[model samples]
Target: MVAASAATCLVVTFVILTWALKDVPWRQIADGSLKPIVVLENANGTPLVRQGPYQGPYISYEQFPDTLINAVLSIEDRRFMDHIGVDPQGIVRALFRNIQAGSVVQGGSTITQQLIKLQYLDSDRTLKRKIQELVIAFWLEGKLGKEEILTRYLNSAYLGAGATGMSAAARIYFDKDVEDLNLPETALLAGLLRAPSQWNPIVNREGARQRTEVVLDAMVDNGKITHLQAGAAKSAFAKVNPTRPTPRSGSWFADWVAPQASEVSGSSPGSTTVRTTLVPRLQEIAEKTIADTLEKSGEAASVSQAALVAMTPEGAVVAMVGGRDYKASQFNRAVTAMRQPGSTFKLFVFYAALKAGLTLSDRVLDAPLDIKGWSPENSGGRYRGWVTLAEAFARSLNAASVALAQEVGLDNVIAAARELGIDAELTNTPSLALGTSEVNLLDLTAAYASVRLGKAPVEPWGIIDFKAADQPEAFRVGQQSPQPVDLSPYQSDLVDLLRLVVEKRTGRGADPGVFAAGKTGTSQNNRDAWFIGFTEPLVVGVWVGNDDDTPMKGVTGGAIPARIWRDFMRQALRNPGPDTMSDDSIAGKDNSPRSCNVSACSRAYRSFRPSDCTYQPYSGERRICER
Candidate 1:
C-alpha cells in the first residue's frame, strides 16, 4: 500500500513539473493582444459597425467597492483569498454538488486560475489544459500578490455588452465609474460573469434580475452581507436600469453579419472589411415603418413585438428588422423566431395542386371539411358552395385548400414547401394544409422570393464578400450561382392567385397603390399574424405578435401586418428605381393585335394593355382580344 501511494505521488509531481516547464505567453499577455477587428459595411461601402475585444481604462485595486469585491468573490470563488492558487476543497465541493444535480451547476476554478486562463491558455476542457492552468495559476501567484492578482483579474475579465473589464462594464451598464457602483448594481455585474450574453441586463431584464438574486443570496450565505442588506439589495436591483451604448441603426443586420465575417476571414491576424448585401436606405425605411406601426397600434391591439425582412428576388437580403427595438432586445426574431405561417402556407398547397393538373379555372367545393376526425372551417362560418380556384384561394377558404391537399397527397404539399426553401418541421396531418407548422420570417420570405422569380427555391444571402487586411484576394459568396428548382410551368397561375388576393380578397390591406402580389395569414386564436408579398423588384415579409406566444386582441395578418408592409413598400418604391413600371409598358403602344393569354396577362399585367382584351371578373379563363 505504501509503495502504490508513493508511485502515484511521484507520477503526479512529474506531470505538474512537465506542465510548469511549458512556455508561458508572457509577452502576449503583457502586450494584451486580442482577436481581430471586423468592420461591416453596407453594399454601398457605408460603414455599418465595427466590433473587437477592446480594453478599457485600467482601474486600481482601491477603486473597487467593498460590495463589488465581496459579491464577485462570494459567487465566483468563495475561498479566493485563503487558498494558494488552486483550491482542492472548492474543487471537491463543486464536483460533489455537480454530481448531485446531474449537471454542471458549479465551477471550481479560482480567481487566479481564471486569470491564468484569460491571459495564457485556451478554454479547452482537457486534463492537460487543466493541469497547465493550475501550474500557470501557481506561477502567477508567485509573481504577484493577492491585491495585484485581483486587480489584474478585474481589469481583464470579460463582462457582457462588449465590455472587457469591470471598469468598462460599470460604464456600459450603469453609465458610471467602477468606484460608484452600489451593492445591487455590483451584484448584477458579478452575476453577468457566468453567462454574459444570456443575462445581459439591457436585453434580458428578467434573466439579469434572477441571476442577481442568486448572487445576493450567495453573499448572504458567505456572511459577506447581512440578510437585511441582501433583501434591500434585491429590492434595489429590481429598479436598476442599464444604459444601451450599442448603436441602434442597422444593429440587427450588423450582429447577424459579424460572425459570418469572422468565419470568412479565417484566422488572419489583422482586421477585415465585410461588404454585405444590406442597403442602408431600405434598412432605415423598414425599421422606421415597424416602429411607427407598433407605436401607433401595438398596445391597442395587444401586439408587443414585430419582425420584418426584405430581400431581392435574386436572394440578396436588403433590409431586416428583427424586433421593434434592437437595444431593448437583441433576439433576432426575423432570423430566429418560429411561428405558424397560417394561410400564407396555403401558397405551397395551391402550387402543389397546380402541378397535379388542376387549373385556376377549375371549380372546387368550399363547404365544411372533415378528414381523420379533424374539421376545418372558413373564417366567417360561411362559404361559397362551389367557386373557381382563384376565388377560393383569394378568399383563403381553408376547406378548399385542405381538400386540394388531400386530392394531391400530403407528401406533394410538403414537397412543394420544401422546394421553396421552408426547412421547418412539418407533420403529415390535416392541420398541415392550414399552415400549422412553424417557420421563421427569413426562410418564409426567401420562399416567396423564389415564387416571384419563377424559381422553386432561392437561397438568401447576407455577406456579399470579405477582404482581410493581409490577403490580396477577397472571399466572395455565391461566386457560382446555385441551381434552383424550375417553377416556370405554374409561375403565372401562382402570380394570378396572389394578385387575386390583393385585388379581391384578404390581402387588400397590403396594396401599395401599384401592381403587387402576396398572401395574408392568421394563426389559431390570432397568436401569429403574417403578410408576405412582393413588388416588381423586392419581396418583403412582416410578422406581429407577442414573444410568449400569447394571442393578440383581434389582430390578423390582413390588418397591422399588411399595413406595415404597405407603408414600407410605399417608402421604398418612392425612389423610382427598378421597382417602378413605366406607363408605356402598362399601355402597350404597338398597334398590332396579339392574343391575351390569361396566364400571361396575370404574370405581366403591369405591362399588359387593357385595350387589347375584355374583362371577365368571375371566369378564370382569359378572354380573346377584340382588336
Candidate 2:
C-alpha cells in the first residue's frame, strides 16, 4: 500500500513538471541577451558617473575567480553539481527550520531554481509558482551548462552602488577589474547576493563582514577551501579597508548635461561617453576653494553657504561649485540662487553709461541726496564730492551709481544687462542701480564674460561631445563662435575701466597677479557678498552668504569672496602662467590707455587734460586718453 501511494505521488509530480515545461523558452537559457548600462565619461575618457536601474556589461564565467563561484555554490546550493535541479534535502531542512520558527525563515531554492525564478518567474510564494520554478530549473539545466547558468546569474544580479553585475560591483567596491579580485573580495561579493543593500559595506560594514564569514565557512565545510585557508581569507578581508565612492564634483554641471545626453545619444544605452567643457583640474580647484573658505571662516562670519561658476570667454563652463558640499545640497546656487547683486550691478550701470553716450571721463556726484524720497549712500557713509564714472565704478559708490542710473534711464541699464546675456528680471526702481533686484551668479558671470569677449555673445554650455555604445563617432556639441556686436570700441574701453577696479580699487582683493578685472558687490546688512571677475581664459563668479537670508558679520564682497576668487585664479593661472604687468596700477600696464578720441569723451570735456584719462578705441588700439 505504501509503494502504491508513492507511485501515485510520482505520477502527479511528473504531470505537473510536464505542464510547467511546455510554455518555457528553453533556448534562451544558453543564449545570453541582456541590456548594458549607460556610462557617463568625462573629457578624459574616465567612466566616473552613471545612473541606474541600469545593467552593466555581462561578465562570462571564464572571467570570474574560482573562489567566487565556490562561495556562491557553497552558500546557495551545496548539492548543485550532484542534484538534477531541486535539492530535496535543502527543501526538507528549510521546512523543518520554518516549522521550528513558526514562519518561513529560509529559502530552499537551489542555484538553478534561483536562476529560473530570476529569468522567467515572478516572486510569488505559492505552491504553483514553486512547482513552475522547479520544472523550469530542470529544463534550464538541461539546455545550459553549469558554467553558463552561473554566468547568467552573476551577470544579472543587482548589486549596490548603482552597479548591476559582478564586473561593475568589483569596479564600484574596490576600483578593480573582475579578474583582479582577490579571494576575500570575491567571497564578500558572493555573500551579497542574498541581500545587496543590507550587506553593503558602505551602509553596514559589520553585516557584510558577518555575511562574508558565513560564505567562508560554507566554502570550508564543502571542502572548496581548508579551515586554515578560510581563516586566512577572513583575516585578510578584515584588515583591508574599502574606499567609498566620493560625491562627484561639478554636480550642477552634470545636472545641466543630463537632458542633453538623451538628445545626443538618441535612444541607445550602455557605455556612453560625454565630453564636456569641464576641466577636471579646474573643477577640483573650484570645489576645494569653496569648501576651504567656508570651513575656515563660515561659522564666525555667520555664513554657511557659498557657490562659484567659472567659464571661458567663449562660454564654456570649466568649473562650477553649486554649493559648499554637493552631497548635502544639489540646488545650483550659481545658476538658481537669485540674491540681490548689490554693487556688482554697478557693472551694468556703468556699462549703460558707456552705451548711452557717457564716457568714463563724465562726472557723477557721490554726495548723498534723496532721489524721489529713496536716499542712497556710499558703504562707509563717506563719499568723494565729484568723481569720474570710472572712479565711481571702481569705488562702488552707491549714491554715484544711482545718480548715474537716473541720468541714463533705468530701462537703458536693464537693456545693457540684457545685451550682455543677463536674463533675470530687473526692477524698474531708483535703487535698481544699487542692485535691489536679485540675480543668479551664472547670468552675472556670463554678463561679465560678454564684456571681456568684446562683442562676442555669451551662450554658456557644459557639453562638448557625446557618444553611446554601438556608435561610430562622438556627437559634437558646445561649439561656440563670437557673436557679432557693434560695441567693439565700447567693449574695449569697458575692459580697461574694469581693469582699474582690480588694479587699485574696491576689487583690489580679487587681483590674481595677472591682467584680471572684476567688480565687487555687497548686499544690505552684508547678507550677500559677490565677486565676478575675468582673466583672458576664464570668467569666475563667487558668492558667499547664508542660505536662510540672514545677515553675515561684515562679509563684504571684497573680503571673503574676493579672497576665494584670488586663490582660485592664482592656482588656475599658475600653470598656463599669467600675463604679468610691470606695475600694480592700471596706468603703468603695457595696455594702459594712451588717449581718449571717442567723440563722446571729447564732447564731454572742454579741453584735453591728462586727468581726463579714459580708454579710447582709436585705430583698433585701446589707449589712455587726455581729451
Candidate 3:
C-alpha cells in the first residue's frame, strides 16, 4: 500500500509541474526588441528642441556603456553571474534579520528576481507574491539566459519622472551618455535603482551622495572593489557637478519659431521650437526688418502686434511670425486671425469672372450699382461708368467688381476660394463680391501661395517628425509614406492671374526691394489693415489693428502694414537671390475683364484710368490709355 501511494504522488507532482510551465512560454520572452523614435531636426540637423515633461526614448542594452553595467554589477550583484536565479544565502540571512528585527523589514530578491517582478510579476508583498515571483523567475531563467535577462532588466526598469531604463538614468542623472560615465557617474546611476525619486541627484544632492556611498559599501561587501577603492570612489563622487535647467532666449527668433510649434503641437502658443518650412536665417532677417521698420516708422507702440510667414513658391512655409511681442500675446494672427480682405479678396471675384469665360477686354458698365438691396460703392465713393474689364480690375473699381461678380456665379467664386484652402462658410450671395466674407490670414496667405505654387492646395504643417530622446533602435518608424500631395484639377491660368493681382494692382504694398507678389486688405471703417506678400523665396503676411477692433485713422493695408512687410522682406531676402518674375502664361480661357466702356464714365473709374480710347493687355483686355 505504501509503494502504490508513493508512485501515485510522484505522478501527480510531475503533471502539476508541466501545467505551470505550459503558460510561461519560455522561448518568446528572450528578445525584448523595440523601435527607436525619430525626432525632427533643422536644416543643420540640430534637433528642433522643445522643453516639457520628459518623454523617454527607450534604449537597449547594447548601447549602454560598460561602465554602467560594471557599476551596477559592482554595487548591486557582483555574484549576478555565479548565481543560478536566486541567492539562497541572502534570502536566509534576510529572513533571520527580519525575525530579529521583529518585522518583514527586508525581503531579499536578486536583481534577476526583481526584473521578473518589474517586467512580468506582481508586487503584492504577501507570501503568495513571493511564491508567484519564484515561478516567473524560474521561467525567466529557463527562457532568457542570465545575460539576456540582465540586459532587458537594465533597459526596461523604471527610473523616475516618466523616464524608464538606464539610458534615461544616464541622461537624467548626469546629463551625459552611458559610455561617457565616469566611476562616480556610474555609482550615481547604480544608487538610483533602489529609489530613483529619493536618490535623485538634482533634487537631493547630499542624500544622493550618501545613498551612492551605501552602494559603494555594498561593492566592498561583495569584494568587487577593495575597501580602499570604495573609500576613494566615495570621496571622488562629491566633486561631480549637478544638472541645471535649460536657459531661455529673448524675442525675434522666439516670435518666429514659437508659433510654428504651437500650431503643430496643439499646445498654447508659448515658447516652443516646432519644425517649420521657414529657414532659420530667413526668419531672423524678417523679424529684424520688422523691428527696424517699426523703429524707423516710430510705430513700435502703435503697431505692437504683427505677424509674418514666408513660403516657397511651391507653398512650403519657410519663416513665420506670430507677433512682434510673443511674450505678451500668444495669438498667432498670421495664421489664426480672420478679417476682411478688401482688395485682396478681389482676385477670387476676377477669377470667378474668368472661369465664366469673361475676357479682360469684355465691357462691363462700372456705373454706380446696387446689388439686390445693397449698393456697392467704389473705394472713394464714385462710379466708373463704362470701362474695359482690365481697367476696372487693374484700378480696383468696386462698382465694376460687384457688377462682374453678378455675371459669374457666386458659387464658382466660393469654389475658387475653397480650392485655395479657404473653408470658411461663405454665403453665396451678391454681397460676396464686395469682400464681405471674413477670412483667416493664414488661409488667405496659403491661397495666394497656391497661385504661386501653380499646384494644388496644401495644408500647413510645422513638424516633419517627432521622436523622444533615447527611443530604441527598433522603434524608429520614421515619417509616413505616400505623403498626401495633390496637384491636379486646378487651372494654371488662375495662378497666372493671381500673380498679376500682386504685380499691377498690389505692387505698391508687396514690393520689398525685389520683384514679389501679394495683396493689401482693409476691413470696413479701417478696423483692420493687412498686407500679404511673397517673394519667390519668401511669403510674408502682416496685420495691423487695435486689439479692440477700433478704427485707426487712415490705416489702409497699403501704408504702415505694407511698409512693415516690405521692410521685413527686404531683410529676409538679402542672402537669397532675387525672385525671378516669370509669367505663368494664363491658359484654359482669357476671362479676365467683363465688358467695360470708358466713354463718359464716372470720375472714380475715369480718374483711375487714363482718358484713352483703346488699350490692350496680354490677357486680351481692351482699354484706352496713353502710350
Candidate 4:
C-alpha cells in the first residue's frame, strides 16, 4: 500500500512539471504576430531605413517533392512514420553506437522531438530539458497528425545563408520552388539539417558537396533510392551551380544591420531601433560620387558597377556604397563579392617581409620570375634590375613582390593577413604575393585600417546602440574601449611606402593635394580596378568593374577608381563636422582648386569669350570650349 502511494505522488509531480513547462504560444506562430519590426538609424540618430518582418510563402506537404521528403526522412529520422514520438529502440541503438565510437555519432530524437525543440523549447542538453522534450514530444504527437508535424518542421527549420524555411532555402540555393527541386538539390537541402552553416553551398561549396553525398548514401541505405539513381544523383550534384539572388533592398547597409539588430533584441516582444555608425552626409557623398562617376565613364570604360567603403581608423564604418545602382542589382560587392585584390594584396607580402627583418632600403630585383613554371612579368615587359623595396612597392612590381614573399615564407605572409583580421581563404602559391586569391572589399579595407591604426585587428562594425521600441534604455554594441596594439617595429616604414604610392607612383590620381597614403591595383586584362587610401581621419577603398567579370577598356586602378576616391575624400573632408570627422584634425588644407569667382575672372580676362573659354569645374581651371 505504501509503494502504491509513492508511485501516485511521483506521477502527480511529473504531471505538474510538464504542465508548467508548456509556455510556447502556438497562436503567435500561426498568425505571425511575433515578428519584430526593425528600424535602422545613422550615427547621429537619424533614421535611415525601416524593415518589416518578411514572410515567404508557406509550402505545404503536398508541394514538397517526393525526393525531398524521402531524403529528410532518410537522414534526419529513418523511423519517423512508425514511431509515436520517442523511440526506445532507436535510443538504445544510438547509446550503444556512441559508447562504441567514444563520441556522439548519431541522434535518436524523432521528428516530433525536433519539431518541439524548434518551436517550443530551448537547445539545452541537460537531463531536465531532455525529459521535458520527451514529454512535450509525446503531447505534440497526440495533438497533430504526422503530415502536419512534418510540414511544420519543414516550414520552421533554420537553413543557413539567412534562410529560415524550406521554401526560402529552395529559392535561396536553387532559385526554384519546393516542388521543383530535383533529387540532388533535394539531397543538398536535406544535408543542411545536420549543420546548416558548415554545409552552406554559398560559402563552403566543397563542404556542401560532401554533405550531399552523405545524404544520398543514407537514402540509398534506407532503400529510398536505387543504386543507379544514387550514382546519377552524384553526377548531377557535382554540376549544380547555385545562383543566389541578392536581398531585394534599397540599401545594402540596411540589410546588413537589420539582421544584427534583430539578434541583439532576441525574442523580446516589441519593435527595435538600431542606431548604426553610418554618417548621413558622408553616405550621401559616397553614393553620389560612385553614381556620377559611373554615369560619366561606365559606358566608355565598359564598367557597369562600382563599390566603395569608408571607415574611421578605429573601425567604425561611416560610409558604404555597395554598387553604382542598388536598384539595378542588390548584390553588395563591397561585403559579399570576392575578387582578386591584385596588388592590394601585396600589402600583406610586404608586411611579412618587414616582420622578417627586411628594410625599405633593401634592394630587390624586379626582373621576370618563374617559380615552379608560373612566371610573373612587369607591365610592358619592363624590368628594373634592382630597386629599393619601397620603390618596388610604390611601382607595384609583380616580380619583385613575389620574390620578397618567397624570402619571407608564404606561411608568414598568410600569418600577416590573419593578424590584420583577413579571414578569407589564402593558398601558399607563389601568385598569392600578387593577390591571385580572392577577397571582399570590406575585409581588405579593414585590414588596411588595422595598419593605419597600428593595431593587430581592427574589426569593422556598423551598429552603435540598439534597443526595443518600448524600452527605456538602449544597449550598446561592439567594444566600448578597444585596447591599442603594440606597434610593429616597421609600422612607420609601411606608412611611408603607402604614401609614396599616392605621391609619386601609380596612385597619383588619388592625391587630393594633401597628406594621403594609398595603393592602386589592376588585375590581369583589367578585369578589376581598385584604389584603397586613407587620410589621417578616414580610410576608403574603391573598386570599379563589370558585374560579369569582363575586362574593361583600358581602365586601371589609377584612373577611374582613384579619381572617385579623391573626389569623395575632398567632399568628406570639406566640412569636417562632428559626426563626419574623427578626433584628430585633418592636417593639410584642401588643395583642390577653388571655384573661381566667375565675375572677377571675367573682369580680369576681358578678351575671354563664352565660346572660346569655358570654366572647367573638375580641375577648377578654364579651358577653351569646343564648338
Candidate 5:
C-alpha cells in the first residue's frame, strides 16, 4: 500500500512537468539565426571570385553515387536503424569499458546525442550539459521520428579537414559520395568521424586506414558483417588511400568571417553558411595581384603576410583575403587588424577640409609647419614651400595635410570619419592627419567607400538571410537591406576632387585606367604599407608588411600595396566607371548661392581662413574686401 501511494505521487509530478513545457516548440530550439552566413555577392551583383584550395566539385546528395553509403554504414553503425536514440546494452558495455579504462575513452551517447552536443550545446564537459542532453533526447524521441533524427544527425556531424556534413565529408574523404563509396571508402569515411582532424586521410592516411580497420573489426565482432568481408574491407582500404591532400575551400573569407560569425552565433558553434558580399573572382584577382607584386618586387622572401578587401559603391564587401592560409593562421588582418592607416587617412583629412570650406584651389604653406611643436616631414624629407592643395595631395605631401588638419581643426576630421562608419577607436592627434592614427583594414576601406556611396555609409555584413534548420518553410530574412548612414550629397564637388587623387596627385600610383580613385599610406619607420582606394565603383584596401613590427625591405605603400589595389580595382571595375563638391553644413544642398544669407560663407574655395570666417557674397563681408 505504501509503494502504491508513492508511485501515484511520482506519476502526478511527471504529468505536471510535461504539461508545463508541452507547449514549447522544438523548431525554435533548432533555429540557426545564431550563426552568420557569408556574403558572396557584391552590392553591384558581382560574385566573389574563389581563389584556390577546393577539395572537389560540390554535388548534391542525389548526384552522389550510392555504393558509398552501403560501405560506410556497413562499417560505422550496422544497427543504425534498429536502435532508438541510445542502445541500452551498448551503453552498459561502454560504461564498464570506460571504468576499466579510467577515463572517457568511450561515450555512451549515440550519433543523435553527439549531434546534439556539437550543434546545440557548448563544448564544456560537465554534468549539466549531460542532463540537458537527456531532456532533449527524450523530447526528440517523441518529437522527431527515428529516421528524421538520424538524417539530421548524419547531415550535421563533422567529418574531417573542415568538411562538416556527410555530403561534404564523403566527397572530401573518398572523392566520392554516400552512394558511390565502396566498402573500403565507406570504412575510411566512417573512421574520419571518430577523430576528423587526426584521422583525416589527407592529413594522415596511415592513421585513417588504421581507424577504418578498427571500425571494420567492430562490425565483424557484432556479426553485422562476415569476418572475410571485414578483412577484405581492411585490405581494400590499405591499398586505396587518398592519393593527395584534401584542399580547403573558402579559407580566406572564412578567416575574416569568424569574428562576425562569433557575434551572430552568440553561444553555439557549428557548420554555418556565412553569406559574404565577396566576389570570388574579385577576391582571386586581389589576392593574385598582391602575390604577383610581392614576387616581382623581390619582397616575397621577407614578407609572408598581407590582407585585402574590396567594396562596391553601396559599401558591400565584395572580396576579402584575410591571410594566405585560413587554417594555418586564424588571425584576420583584413577586418580586425588595427594597424596605422598612415597617409590613407588623408582622404578624410581632405574631405574635412572641403567640408570646412577649404578647396583644391586653396594655397597653404607646406614649409616648416609644426603642430604643438610636433613637426611632420614630407615623405622624401623635403617640403615644397608654397603649393596648391591639389599639388600637395598629388605628391602625398605630409606637411600639407598636417597643415590642413591644424587649419580646419582636428575635431572636424574626427567627425567626418565618424560619418563614414569609421568606428575604429580613433585617437585624433594632429599627427593623425598624416595617418599616424591606427585603424583596421575594414574600417579604413569602409570610410573611403563613404565617398563612393555618396552620403550614406554602409557597414560590412556577412549573413543576409537565415532560418532555423528545423523549419522547412519558416525563416528570417534581412528585409529592406542595409540601412543608409546619411551623408550630404551636395558634397559631389568634394567627391570629384577626391577622385583626382588617383589620377593627378599622390595617388597617381593607384590609377588603374578610367575607373578608379585611391590613396597610399606608409606608417612611421615603414612598419606598415597600405594602399586604400575606390574605383568609379568598388572600394579596395590592401595592407602588406610583417606580422611583427620589423620594417620590410624596400617596400612602400605606393609600390607593392598600390599595385595590388590597382590590379584588384582594375578587375573589379572591368564594368567601366565622381563629381563636384558641396557643403554638408547646409543640408548638403547648399548649392543655391543666390539664397545664401551668411555674409562670411563663400561658395568659392579659400585657404587658411580663421575659424570665424564663413562663405559670403563679395559685397557681404570684411574678408571679401581683404580678398
Candidate 6:
C-alpha cells in the first residue's frame, strides 16, 4: 500500500512540474535579446566611440577560441557534457560539504542551472526557487541543446571592467579579439567568472594570477589539458599583463556629436548607430597635432590649454580637438569656451568695411587715437602713420582696425559677422574692432569658412547619417547644399588680402605651399592667440592659451599658433590637386569695379564689380574713381 501511495505521489508531482514548465517563455529563451548601446562611427565607417553603458558588442560561438571554451568548461562545470541539466553528484557532494562547514560555502550549480537562475529565478535561497531553477535548467537542456546553451552562457556572463561577455572582456582586458587570446589570457578570463571584480587582472594582478593558476589546474584535472600544458600556461601567465585603458582619439568629437545623433536617431532608450562627418585621418591629425605641440611647447609658453576645429567650406566638421588631452578635461573649448578673438575679430570688421564700398586700397591711420576716451595703440606702441587697410590687416595694427571700425558703423560690423555665423554678443565700442567681445573658436572658424566657400554661408554640421536596427534609413540625413550669399564679387579680393597676410605679414608662419589665406589674432596681454586659415578644400582654426584666462609667455598669434596651424595644414595639403590654387591666384582680377560709391554700384558689387567710383557723403553724389 505504501509503494502504491508513493507511485501516486510521484505521478502527481510529475504532472504539476509539466504544468509549471509551460510558462517558461520559450521564445525569449530561444532569442537572447540584450541591452542595446549607441555606437558612433567615423566617415570611413570605423567605430569612433561608444556611448551607452549597458550592452557591448556581440560575438557568436564560432568567434570564441577553443582554448577559452575549454578553460571556461573546466573551471565552471566539469561534468557539463555528461549531465542532462543538474548534476546530482555535485549537489550531493556540495550538501555534505555545507553540512560539515555548517553553512552554504559551495554551490553545486552547473553552467546550465546557473544560466537558468540568471534568466528566470531570483536569489531567494528558498526551496521553491531552487526547484524552479532545476525545472528550467532541464527545459533549457532539452530545448537548446549543449552547444546553444554554452554559447548563451558564454555571451550572457558578466566580466569585470564594464565587460559583458567574452568579446567585451577580450577588448577591455587585452585590447584583442577572443580568437587571438593566448592560453594565459583564456585562463585569466575563466578565473574572472568566480568573482569578476575580485579576480579582474586590471584591478588585482597578483590575486588574478593566483586565480588563473587555480583555473589552469582545474583544466588539467578535468582532462581538458595535460599537466605539461598547465605548467606552460602558468609560466605564460606570469609574463602576461593587461592593457591599461587610455583616452580614445575621437572622444571630444563624440561628445559634440552625441546630441545631434540623439535627434537624428530618435531619443529612444535602445541602441542607435550614428554616422558622423568626422574623417578619421583628419581627426587623428588634429589630435596628434595638439598633443605633440602641447608636449613640446606647453610648459615653456605657460600655455596649458588649446582647441582646434577643421571643416569643409560647406561646414561639414572633419576634425576637432577640444583640448590638449580629453582625459585631463572633457570641456570642449572649441565649441563652448568663449574667449577674446583678438585680431581674428578684424576679419569681420574688414568684411563689413569691404561690404560698405571700402576697398583694400582704402586708407586708415595706424597712429594712436581715442574713441570715447578709449585710446587704441598698435602693438609695441609704434605707429606706421597712415596705411592702407590691406597693410594694416597684414600687420594686425590695432589703431588702424579701430579707425576702420569707426568709419564703418559698428552695427554693420555686427551684421556682417552675423552673416558668417559669429553670434556672440558684441558691445558697440571701438574696442570691438580689437575683438574685445568673446566668441567661441567653433563659430569663429565657421565664419571664416564662409569666406572660403564664397558662394554661401556655412552652417556647421557634424552628423552625416544616423540609424537603428528598426529604422530603414537615417532620419534627418541628407546632403546639404551651400546657401547662396552676396560675397561673390569680393571673394577673390578678400582672399587676396588674406593671402598677403600669410605671405608677407603676421600669418607668414602659416603659409603652406598651397594657396592659403588666413588671419592671426593676439589678444591683449597675450591672454589669447589664434590662427584661422583655409586651403581650397579645408578650413581650420586653432587657439592656444591658459585655461584661467591668464597671459602666456609672450606667445603671440603669429608665433606658436601659426606654427601649429602650418604644420597641420601642410599634412592636410599633401595630396594637392589641380583644383587647388597657388599664391599666384591672389594677383588675378575679377574685372569687378575696384570701388563703388552709389547704392546701385554697391548692389552690383554684391554679384560683380561695378565701375570704381567715390561717394561724396557730404554732397550726396557719386563720382567715378581710378584704382
**Clash pairs for candidate 2:** 593-623, 593-624, 594-623, 594-624, 595-624, 595-625, 596-625
Task: Specify the highest-TM-score model's number.
Answer: 6
Q: Name the better of 4 and 6 by TM-score.
A: 6
> Candidate 5 residues 588-618, lDDT tens each?
2322122211112322433212122223444
lDDT of 1: 0.80
Query: How would you encode candidate 4's per-residue C-alpha lDDT over 556-618 as one tens digit per residue?
Result: 899999999999999988977876645221111223221222223344454432211243545
Cα lDDT of model 2 by residue, 1-627, tens digit: 999999999999789778766666655554544443444555444444443343444565788888888888888888888788888899999999999999997778888887777777778887778777776777677777678778778877777766677877887787777888888888888888888888887678899899899999989999999999999998998764655445354677777666655444433323455556666677788899888988999999988999998887767677788888777788888888899999988888888888889898989988877967779988879989899988898888888888899999899999888788777888899988998899999888988888887764587766555544444444444233345566686887788878988998888999988899998899999999999989877889999998899999999999999999999999877764222111111112223223223333435543322222234454564444433
Sort all candidates by TM-score, best to worst: 6, 2, 5, 3, 1, 4
- Note the residue pairs that clash in candidate 6: 592-609, 593-609
Better of 3 and 5 by TM-score: 5
| Candidate 2 Cα errors over 4 Å, as ranges | 1-38, 49-122, 127-156, 160-163, 177-188, 195-241, 248-256, 262-271, 275-280, 365-370, 478-487, 574-627
How many residue pairs clash in all the candidates, one count each? 0, 7, 27, 0, 51, 2
Question: On a 0 to 100 scale, what is the lDDT of residue 141 in model 2?
Answer: 78
- The candidate with the higher TM-score, 3 or 4, is 3
Please give the distance, in angstroms, between residue 28's alpha carbon in candidate 5 and its true position after superposition. 15
**Candidate 5: Cα lDDT at 567:** 73
Q: Mind giving the per-residue lDDT tens digits that candidate 3 earns over 1-627?
A: 999999999998677666545554344344543322222334332333323333233444676666567767766666677777788876887799999999985556788888877765556676556655677776667677777777777766766644567655665555665567776677777888878888778888898899788777877776667789878888898788757323122233334444443322222111122233335555556667665665665353355556666655445455566666555666766766777777778778876676677777788888876666788777787776888776776667778888888777788888867766778778777777767788766677777766666554645443332222321111111112123334433344444444455566644756665566666777788877787766665555677776676776677777787877777776665555322112111110222222222222222232322112234545566644322
Better of 5 and 6 by lDDT: 6
lDDT (Cα) of model 4: 0.79
Q: Which candidate is the best by lDDT?
A: 1
Which runs of model 4 end up more than 4 angstroms from their true locations? 1-34, 50-250, 480-485, 583-627
Candidate order by lDDT, decreasing, is: 1, 4, 6, 2, 5, 3
TM-score of 6: 0.71
Query: What C-alpha lDDT do the candidate models reach, one value each?
Result: 0.80, 0.76, 0.60, 0.79, 0.62, 0.77
| RMSD, every candidate, angstroms | 18.1, 14.2, 16.1, 22.2, 14.3, 13.9
Compute each candidate's TM-score over C-alphas: 0.60, 0.71, 0.60, 0.58, 0.63, 0.71
Q: Kindly indicate the candidate among 1 and 5 with the higher TM-score.
A: 5
